[model samples]
Target: MKKRLVVAITGASGAVYGVRMLQVLSQLDDWESHLVISSSGALTALHELTMRRPEIEALADVVHNVRDIGASIASGSFQCDGMVIAPCSMRTLAAVAHGLADNLITRAADVMLKERRRLVLLARETPLNLAHLRNMTAVTELGAIVAPPMPAFYNLPGTIDDIVNHTVGRTLDLFNVEHAGLLQRWQGLKKTAALVKESVSREHLISI
Candidate 1:
């Protein structure tokens, strides 16, 4: 059975993360993605990625307006496997932390919490002050996975796509999604050793 997934894009600087997440979700056969974009998110997507709002909307299986508090996702009865907020803003995080469901995104998040569904928050902010950490702790206590968008250098990422894929792959991991060709696992390093051995052999022959 396909899992119902809710993806919310709040007012954050990293709109590319949200775009890549939607693109990845579209390729999944066993998942249905419901998307909600905050008003500032739309602007950020346009300014950062130069993608039009309609084009962004087309990426998701279902698009819900952020202002629509009456949306089905806001209710606990709407059965969803999990909810992910890619590039979650501080404002949204704080709102959800305090149980203030003023908008559809926070409201749906609250529903996920109350319903004991998986909630993954990709909090995108820097220089975490005490307040941010406190809010994160509060949500974590409620069974929400508060993942910050921190890049990993072990992947030897070369391009922007590499970074995006690594982040998305990590996000998918929270939902137990298997992602290949994104990041190499530690066990996969065995292949790199073989390549290095071959390179060393070739170098020795050339030197001889």
Candidate 2:
């Protein structure tokens, strides 16, 4: 059987993260992607990506209605490998933290928690308040990974795509998803420093 992953996109700022994730998952023949997009998520994607809902939905193998409480993913018996909420909005995070299960997105997340499956939340917010921090802490205590998509300077990304890909790649890593060539792996700093020194030395010789 193919490995199944539930990808939920909420009304977060970085809707592109979820889109990129689905795009990547579509490449893996052995993996199946089940997608759920909240109403706000669709609106956000339309605004940010300038893509219609159908275009975004086309990237996934399966799409579930946000209001469908009885979807396969909403139940623990559906047997999914894991779930990821890319660019997880604070509202969704709170819902998951509180075990709201008010909608299919939160309901599916609740199932993951109850089933002890991997649950990764790409929490997107900055200058967080106490409530946000508490909700993050609460979810962590419940066995969910709260991964914020902070950019890495070590990669020396030259473009926005590089930075976004790096974050997506890291999120995939939490699920042990194989996304080769998505992001540059960090070699040790000593090795990188030596390379930099070598380039600088060559520059000095040329200038002399």
Candidate 3:
């Protein structure tokens, strides 16, 4: 049986993370992806990625309507390995934190929490207020990982796509998804220095 993962794309600014995640996970033979996108997520996709609803939905093996509370994913018996809310908005975060099952996204998330399944929330926000902080803490207590998409400069990303890919790669890591050697994983300082020297040597040899 393949591992099942539920992916939710919220209204947060980084829709590309969820899009890229679906794109990659769809290709993995060992995993099946169940996708749910919020209404505001569709808007953000249009504004941030210029992606239409169908375009984004096509990336997943299974698409669930956000309003369909009776979806199979809403039940813990569906047997999913985990759930990830990429670019998780503060609104959705609060929803999941409070066990509010007003929508499929939050409902599925609530099921995961009650069932003790791994739930990763890539919460995207800045200058968080006390309410936001408390909400985050609330979710943490219930076993949800509040992961904000903080990019690492160590990769020396050269483009916007690079930064986005780096974050998407890390977010997938929380679900134990392999990158298929696409993204650069962080090696220790010794290995990094050696890699740098090897790259320099290769460049020097190329010039020679």
Candidate 4:
């Protein structure tokens, strides 16, 4: 059976993460993506990516309305492999931390927790307060990964797309999704140290 993943977009700053994840999933034949975008998420996408709801929904194999509490993904028997809330807002984080299944996005997250399925949240916020930190801790205790979209400088990303791709790629890594060439992998620093040592030896021989 094709692996199923639930992708939710909340009202966060980095909607591109969610959209990029859907784009990557769309290219994988062995994977199926179910998308749910909150109303505020839709607005944020428009503001950030200039993408309409239809345009974003097109990337998913199936799209569920945020208000649809009866969606298949909201049930533990849905047989989903995992769920990710890319660019998860602080509000959504609090809801999931407190087990508030008020909307379909949070509802499906609740299902993932109850079923012991993988749940990843790309929490997007800066200058986090105590409440945010405590909620993050709560979600962590509940088996939900609160992965904020922090950029890695080791990749030497040249453009915004590169940074975004690296973030999305790392998120896929958590789900064991195949995303080759999406970002540069870290090679050990031992090679660089060896090169430096060789250079120093050559310099010493020249001095002699």
Candidate 5:
């Protein structure tokens, strides 16, 4: 049977991360995605990314409203492989850390933690205060992986899409997902130079 992956998007600034994750998951055959979005997430997505709410909703196999606390995902028996909160807002993070299942996203995350399943949170914020640190520490202590969407300069990304894909690729890596051609891995500059030189030399030889 295919593995179920729960994806939650809360009220965070990086809405593109959530959208890219859904797009990436859509390409995988062995993974089924159940999506949930907070109401504020919808607003942020529209205002920031100019994405229609329906466009985001259509990306998932099943979309649950954040208000739906009694959804199937709330229970630990849902048999999910993992849960990922892309662009996890501080509000949602606090709820998850405190085990306050006021919404479906928090409830699902709580279930993941209780069941000892993988819970990856892509926390998006800067200049985090003590409260943010405490919540992150609390969740990490409970076996949740807190991954901030920090950009990697090593990838030498040239475009906005490159940065987004790299972040999403790293996020998928936390789930042990096999993704190729998404982001370039770090290779020694000498080796890369040699490879490029070899290619140029071959072309020169062909021209001769």
Candidate 6:
């Protein structure tokens, strides 16, 4: 059977993660995407991506209204494989951590947690305050993975899209979904001697 994954886009800096997620998922035959975009999410997409509303909506298999708390994805019985909130805002993080289901994005995430399903949040803030850390810790304690999309310079990404796709691919790894061939896995370092030297250096530093 095809797996269903709910994807939410929130008001955060990395709108591209959400957009790239939809674009990648759209090409996969084994998975279906349910999308929810917050009011602020839409505004951010326009400002950050300069993408039209229709263009954004066109990428998802099913688009949900942020105000529709009664949507199918809002229920625990919806039987989706998992949910991902790409570029998750700290506000949304606090709400989900506190069990606030005022909006569909938060509501669906709440359901994912209650049902013991995988819920990945690409938290998009730096210089985190205590509240943000507390919220993240709270959600993590409840089985939600707070996966901030920190860039991997190790991948040697050539462009912004490469960086985004690499992060998206690893995020999708949680659901066991095969990415659209964009994920670059880390093989053993070309110079094993370098790894040995680095490990020895760290050990010596600790000893010192």
Q: Give me the overall lDDT of model 5.
A: 0.91
lDDT at residue 159 of model 3 (Cα atoms)? 86
In candidate 2, residue 157 scores what lDDT? 97
Which candidate's lDDT is highest? Answer: 4
Q: Once model 1 is optimally superposed onto the true structure by TM-score, how far is the C-alpha of residue 3 displaced, in angstroms?
A: 1.3
Instruction: Return the TM-score for each candidate structure.
Output: 0.88, 0.93, 0.89, 0.94, 0.90, 0.91
> Stretches of candidate 2 above 4 Å error?
195-208
Query: Per-residue CA lDDT of candidate 1, range 9-87, in tens?
Result: 8788888888888888888888888999999888888999999889999989988999899998999999888899988
Clashing residue pairs in candidate 6 (N, C-alpha, C atoms within 3 angstroms): none
The global C-alpha lDDT for each of the candidates, from Candidate 1 onward, is 0.89, 0.95, 0.91, 0.96, 0.91, 0.92
Tell me the tens digit of each residue's lDDT in model 6 across 141-180: 9999999999898878899888888899999898998765
Instruction: State the lDDT at 67 in candidate 2.
Output: 98
* Candidate 3 local lDDT, 1-208, one digit each (tens): 9999999999989998899889889889999999999999999999999999999999998999999999999998989899999979999999988889999999999999999999999999998999999999999999999888888888788888788888888778888887765468877699778999999999999999
Cα-based lDDT at residue 141, candidate 4? 96
In model 3, what are the clashing residue pairs, if there are any? Answer: none
Ten residues in sequence with the least summed lDDT for candidate 6? 179-188
lDDT of 6: 0.92
- Residues 1-208, candidate 2: write the lDDT tens digits: 9899999999989999999999999999989999999999999999999988899999999999999999999989898889999889999999999999999999999999999999999999998999999999999999999999899988999999999999999989888888898899987799878999999999999999
Per-residue lDDT value at 66 in model 4: 96
Error of 2 at 14 (Å): 0.2
* Least accurate 10 contiguous residues by lDDT in model 5: 184-193
- In model 2, the Cα lDDT at residue 22 comes to 97
Q: Please provide the root mean square deviation of candidate 3 (C-alpha atoms, Å).
A: 4.8
lDDT of 4 by residue, 39-74 (tens): 999999999999999999999999999999999998
In the predicted model 1, the residue pairs found to clash are none
Q: Per-residue lDDT tens digits of candidate 5, residues 1-208?
A: 8888999988999999999999888889988899999888999999988998899989988888888888899998888889999889999999999999888999999999999999999998899999999999999999999999999987789999999999999889888888888899777688778999999999999999
The C-alpha stretches of model 1 lying farther than 4 A from their native spots are 188-208
